[model samples]
Structures are given as C-alpha cells and as structure tokens.
Target: MAKGHRSQIARLRNENKDTRPSAKVSYARVSVTKACFVLDAIRGKDVTTALGILAYNNRYASSVIYKLLKSAVANAENNNGLKADDLYVAECFANKGPTMKRIHPRAQGRAYRIEKRTSHITVVLDEKK
Candidate 1:
C-alpha cells in the first residue's frame, strides 16, 4: 500500500511467476518446421504424457526433443526445487538458427548451393497453479 512496499510486491510477484526450470538445446541440425511437428503434439501436457508423446513420435526430431524434455523435467525437480509430477510442458518450440552454405558439384562445370538449416529448441515447464 505504501510507496516503499510497492517494489517488494513487484519482486514477490516476479518470484512467484513461474519459477520453474527450463532447458534449451541450440544449434540442432533440424528445421523449425520439423521440430514444431513434435512440439505441437506435447505442448500444455503433463510431463509424463509429453514424454509418452515424444517416445512414439515417428519424426527424427522427436529423439532429440525427448531428451531435452527429460532434461527440463529434471531441471524442474533438481534446480527449481519443484516436483516433477506437479509440472507440465507449459511451452515448447523451435526457432530457425544459422544456415550453413555449401557448394555441391554439378554437371557442365556448374555448382549447386546447399543450405543446411539449424534450429534452436527450448522447453519450458511450470507447476500447475
């Protein structure tokens, strides 16, 4: 209510706002679109259920994502001092990263350009509030 106390309230709000742990895997050799396919299936789901979804996914990105998700859940439990069962995959997504350019040999003394795509994937989990 007082001027000096307003800053304290703000700090408390920030501390209480989703202090769960997260993990990020950057420069993954996968495109954002491909990663999103797997992320879209697990977003807003419990940790166990999200892992289940990742396990059965046929996409190649799922393997990497599954490990990242597990890391996030572990972080929540160990670092953030939160229970794994109380957390869920609040957010998961991938963004395009740097592209590697290469030249491929072609017929008639020509060259073909190759763009190797990369992505930065992040998984954020939070306790159900």
Candidate 2:
C-alpha cells in the first residue's frame, strides 16, 4: 500500500513535466470569454505571426494578451535557452477569476447587483520540432 501511494505521488508530480516555457497573468481585469477570443487566435501559431495578430486586433483583451505572450517568448529565450524565432504557441487559455460585486442603486429604493468579472490567463510556448 505504501509503495502504491508513493508511485501515485511521483506520477502526479511528473504530470507537468513539459519543458516548454510559460507565463501567466492572474486576476487580469478581463472576462474569460473576452480573453478566450484573443487566445483562440494565437494558439498553434508561430511567435511572430501571433504577435502580428495581437498587435492589429481591436479587442481590449488583445492588448493584455499581447503583453503576456511577449513575456512567454522572453521566458523561453532567456530561461529555457530556446530561440524566439523557432518558438510557437503550444497552448493559451483563460480561466475565470473571482468576480468583484457591487450594488447599483435603482429607483424606488431598489438595488441591482453588478458583477465585474476577472480572469487568469496563461500562455505556453514551445520550440518547433
């Protein structure tokens, strides 16, 4: 039983064994749905091409994602010793974060709940094989 538990722990630790460099932006002031729109455009694209798309995109989320992508590329080059020219976006995603709640005053002493959504974004880059 002890041997089985130890093996399971080892496997769990190795689950994220990928050497690709990644960057994350937590609690960004953007909704997950909005961020996903930008993330979808960059996935599987070369670093240069992805930057081009992000640079020209008009969405507000694109601006935030653009910075995050650049950080990931820099991480790959400096930390992972990978070439920026050969890097591609292996994965990009945005997850929902805690929402800030506020009350809006309405007519007749009524109050309306307002939610400001936030997201956590991650970008992973890998070298072309």
Candidate 3:
C-alpha cells in the first residue's frame, strides 16, 4: 500500500487493466479437451475466418464457442470502439469448472461414479496491429 489517494489508486489500477475485448461462458457442459479442440482452430484466425470455421464445424463445442466468439466480436466493436474487420482471436482457452458427480448403478447394488465435467471457456480478441 503506497501513499496515494483513493481515486489515484483506482486510476492506476485502471491503467494496468487489460483493454482487449473478451467473452467467457461459465459452467459450459463441454469438457476442456473438447472445447480446446474448437478453440485451437480459431486461436489466431481473423474474426471473419473464425466465424466461418465455427459456422460449419460439426463439433458440439464449436456451436457454443461460436456464439461466445460472436459476443466477443460485438464487445470489441461496441465496447472497445474497434472495427470488426480488424479483430482477431488473440487468446482463447478453456478452464476446468465444477465436476458434477452422478451415481450409476451396476449389477446388484454396486454403485459406480460418473462425472459430468464442466468447463469455463474464454475467448479474448484484439485488434490487428
């Protein structure tokens, strides 16, 4: 805690904040590995190309990521005052979320645990420099 006024400290924090536009989906039903497959395809591609890839991809995660990517693009355009054409997928990844455990009954009275995994997926976009 350095000596500074409250407003000044807030200003300093704002200066260090990441200005890039991004979107995240929490507790997405898809697993990290599956989401990463879609994320990997569009990680560095331009927004238009990324959308195109997402549009035609057959993976379930692609549909979720596609909507998330669209939201990120809208954020870049509206919130960041950036043009859609100049934006690209700068960074994107998925993180593990809470795992929901379910019980599967086996033969007799044996119980087996089944994990319904969830993930938090994020897509960060930046303007092409």
Candidate 4:
C-alpha cells in the first residue's frame, strides 16, 4: 500500500515520470519478437538515420515502428521543445500484450488453439548531450 493520500501519490508519481518524449502503440497486432527486430535496428540511432533504416526495411513491424518513430520525433519537437536533429532513440522496445485465441480445427475433429499475439511498442527519444 502507498503511504500517501491520493493527491500526494499522484503528485509523487508525476514527479518521477520520464521526461523524454516518446510514443507508444497499444495492442499492436505484431508479435514481440518481430517488433524487437525493428527496434534493435534503431535503438541508439539518430532520428533521421533511424527513419532511413525503417524506410528501407522490408519487415512488417518496421512500418508500424516507422510511424511510431516519426510520432516520437514530432513529440520531442512540439512537446519537449527539442530539435529533431539532436534526438536519438534512447530506448525502443515491444512488450507483450493480450493474445487473441482462435480455434483451429485439425484432423479427427480436434481443435487446436492458435494465439494471435499482440504487443505494445514504445519509442523513447532523447537529445544528445
């Protein structure tokens, strides 16, 4: 249990919040492994180079992450008042989200469970010091 009132807890939580600009896509219809392949490419790269990598990559997750990266860059510029040129991907990851289960009928009327996995992808951007 928390040791503070509701308002106090809210204020304390807000104080420790991450200040770097970022963007997240919840319930993205891509698996964590696939998304990590894209995230690994741009983890520490500058925004322009990261975008370039995403632009040419042929992976499906790259497309989703491409738009997400752009949104993060825009967030840094508009919300954080930071220059896009100075920003790099500080942290980018995909966490597991809810899995949608589907039934796949097999031989002898056997039903197999097919899981359609989803992920929550996040891209955090920070200015180079």
lDDT against the true structure, per candidate, is 0.91, 0.93, 0.95, 0.95
Ranking by TM-score: 4, 3, 2, 1
Residues 10-94, candidate 2: write the lDDT tens digits: 8977996887899999999999999998899999999999999999999999999999999998898889898899999999999
Predict model 4's lDDT versus the native.
0.95
lDDT of 3 by residue, 25-110 (tens): 99999999999999999999999999999999999999999999999988888898999999999999999999999999999899
In model 2, the number of clashes is: 0
Which residue pairs show backbone clashes in model 2?
none
lDDT agreement of model 3 with the native? 0.95
Residue 94 CA displacement from its true place in model 2, Å: 0.7
Candidate 4 local lDDT, 1-129, one digit each (tens): 779789999999999999999999999999999999889988999999999999999999999999999999888989989999999999999999999999999999999999999999999998999
Q: What is the lDDT, from 0 to 100, of the residue 23 in candidate 2?
A: 96
**Please, what is the TM-score per model?**
0.84, 0.89, 0.91, 0.92
lDDT of 1: 0.91
RMSD of 3: 1.7
lDDT of 3 at 117: 93
lDDT of 1 by residue, 1-129 (tens): 435588888987788786658999999999899999999999999999999999998899999999999999888878878988898988888989999999999999999999989999999998898
Cα error of candidate 3 at position 61, Å = 0.5
Residue runs of model 3 more than 4 Å from their true location after superposition: 1-9
